[model samples]
Target: MLINELSKKTGLSIHTIRYYENLGMIKGLADEKVKSNNYKHYNNNTIERLEIIIEAREVGFTLAEIKKILTSWFETTESKPETLELFHAKIKEIDDKMRYFKQTKRLLEKVCEKIQNNE
Candidate 1:
């Protein structure tokens, strides 16, 4: 599929896809060229990678982390342990964040209730 098809499938704009490609989030895509009218073509693998990258970002994985995972997948070493460790760490981080947010929410609710009672 081409960039437009990828954009439709991934629900991301072509410009954003280009930006991701430039940012090294997704690799092996063609660079812009004056030839072929400056249009870029993408394969199914690229589309799949874009989907993974989008999901990873949504789950709070930075571009550098995603790039490391992708590179590991491409490298000679198997990445199962590394990927598992990364996900486990992310889970812990999210759990801590959730705990803090819950505490903050409770405090805010108490404050709001006191303000309402006073008014």
Candidate 2:
């Protein structure tokens, strides 16, 4: 399908899809038969790649990290253990950040209470 169709199917904006394509996370191919305009067509593989990108980003994976993981996933199966390890590390990082946020929230609440008491 065309880029517009792909965008609708993936629920991603055209600019975002083009951005990913520019970053080499996905690719679109121009049809050889159509010489009137340089329209690029996307296939199922592009959709799958975009889905992977979306899931990874939701879990806090940066684009560079996602690219590495996708490269490994597409190139060979030897990186399965490594990918699992990365995910575990990301989970730990999230846990640590959540604890930090909780502490900060409590501190802010205490400050607010102190200000109200002084008033």
- lDDT of each structure? 0.81, 0.92
What is candidate 1's lDDT per residue for 47-99, written digit by digit as tens? 77887888899999988888777777656378768977888989999999999
Estimated TM-score per prediction? 0.80, 0.87
For model 2, name the residue pairs that clash: none
Name model 1 segments beyond 4 Å from true. 27-36, 74-76
Give the TM-score comparing model 1 with the true structure, all chains together: 0.80
Please give, for residues 12-76, the per-residue lDDT of candidate 2 as tens digits.
99999999999998989998998999899999988999999999999899998898888888877
Kindly report which residue stretches of model 2 are placed more than 4 angstroms away from their true locations once superposed: none
Q: What is the lDDT of residue 106 in candidate 2?
A: 100
